[model samples]
Target: MNDHDGPTPGNLVATVRAVLPSLTPAAQAIARLILEDPAMVARSTITEFSAVSGTSEATIVRTARALGFAGYSQLRFALAAAVAREEPERLVPGDLGPDDPLTDVIAKVTRAESEALADTAAQLNPDRLGTVVEAMVAARRVDVYGVGASGVVAVDMAQKLMRIGRPGHAFADAHLALTSAALMGQGDVAVGVSCTGETPDVIAPMQLAHKGGATTVAITNNPRSSLAELADHVLVSAGRETAFRPGALASRISQLLIVDCIFVGIAQRTFETSQAAVRATRSALDEYMADTRRRNK
Candidate 1:
């Protein structure tokens, strides 16, 4: 496939330039609209673009088809990717400025979540994530190890997997984690979550697990991080850098989303087993709560 074959909404400007001359007058008009305002193309649907460009939906589809995508979805994805690359500093909408009034916390949180969703879209690699999930699903056991703020996310993932009857542990202590890592073998899975991906404490154990022949998964903000390089499968977290604002917020949120994605994938793939596990776990918790209530009474 040539460069044009993988056109994303982000590269619509380039695609328009490359294909404009070849298109008929009607298609060229749509191309002009896209180049003039690629963000509009990124934010709007094909039908909306067609209406705003004064062209028919068929014309838009034909234009995208001519540009080498299977359909309009591919074209829009390309456009959004291109736009995201251009703006490295765009906070999620309402997060544009800091120091808002106390009453605006809700709006701020909403914007932050919106940005998280967009970052997830811009950075996620479905193929890579699927591979990691597959490894977790087939593993004999799973170990989740992390340190610092990422450690919290690791523990949260462990709890969720436990509910689904996956035998896993989240290790916060360096020594205990290393010992557990030494026990990992082929068919086991070891996960390391680190935003910077350079934490020595987290990497040391994951490296041992990798050497033990276990399938390793690393969820990190940096795709090029040492953690990603060490693990067999990498789940990337999309987050923005900020000053005075802790990486804790963005990194943890992204990590949570990554865990959620993996959990959902595993649940869908092992529907019956996961459902039974969930039910059993919930029942156990209810029974424990009932016993506590009776004692109090």
Candidate 2:
């Protein structure tokens, strides 16, 4: 369920990251090794993994259980399943190099975006999603916060909510975000979006929102991130990129995927009002355009 309760099959890496912050130093090292290359961990024996990871077998077993596995054997089985599901011959992190032609660039970019969405879907738990949706729909207002690429997502979420007859606001400026968050109370839902989940711009407002008794939510790639720690609900996304690939590109795509789902869920729950709102907005726009044309004529 990506609830950080435990990892599902072929989703070991994401779940491991979700719980990494709570693990001991020794356990964190093992978790990092698995994140770096699960295939290698899957193939390595417990003794070899311990030797390479610089941790004892005892710590390794503890790490496994801490990650929600019954033991080391279960952890290995999950890691192996995750590795076996990787795309064959795919680019490492699906990054485009300087020498790649335009054609390859097009194909590679599309493939990377597609996989990011798919990976996020695989990790997303419908129950978790339902909970977030319920919060948004019931709140008196929804406030979304982000900076840079994530700011775009925040704006989109706010705009969609407004269209569906919900009071929504988005903030990119740190001061204004905190100002709004400070006023939010139990009737508000505050969503902070950050790819790395460590952006100070985002964390500050989220902190304020939480302190003000708002229901806070975090949308991030790293589930164990600081931003995630402040929220009542966490929606984790997936990002696959190389050092050369900009962090904003792949991460933003996954963020948008979650935003889209949230919008749809809200709309589905308020079907009558949502449809009426859309129709009214469309009619108003058409009337404005027609009046402008007549004046020009």
CA lDDT of every candidate: 0.75, 0.83
Point out where model 1 deviates above 4 Å: 1-100, 103-106
Off-target runs (Cα >4 Å) in candidate 2 are 1-5, 13-40, 52-55, 62-70, 83-91, 292-297
**Model 1 per-residue lDDT at 161:** 89
lDDT of 2 by residue, 75-106 (tens): 88887777676622231444678899999988
Model 1 per-residue lDDT tens digits across residues 1-297: 001124444333333443455579998887766666667876888778877988888888888787767777777777677677773234123443467675686666555655655565555567777887888899899999998888998999999889898887999899999999999999999999987788898999999998999888888765556787888777666544345346547668878998999999999899999999999988999999999999999
Clash count, predicted structure 2? 0
**Candidate number achieving the greatest TM-score relative to the actual structure:** 2
What residue pairs clash in candidate 1, if any at all? 8-78, 8-79, 9-77, 9-78, 9-79, 9-80, 10-78, 10-79, 10-80, 10-82
Backbone clashes under 3 angstroms, per model: 10, 0
Task: Assess every candidate by TM-score.
Answer: 0.68, 0.86
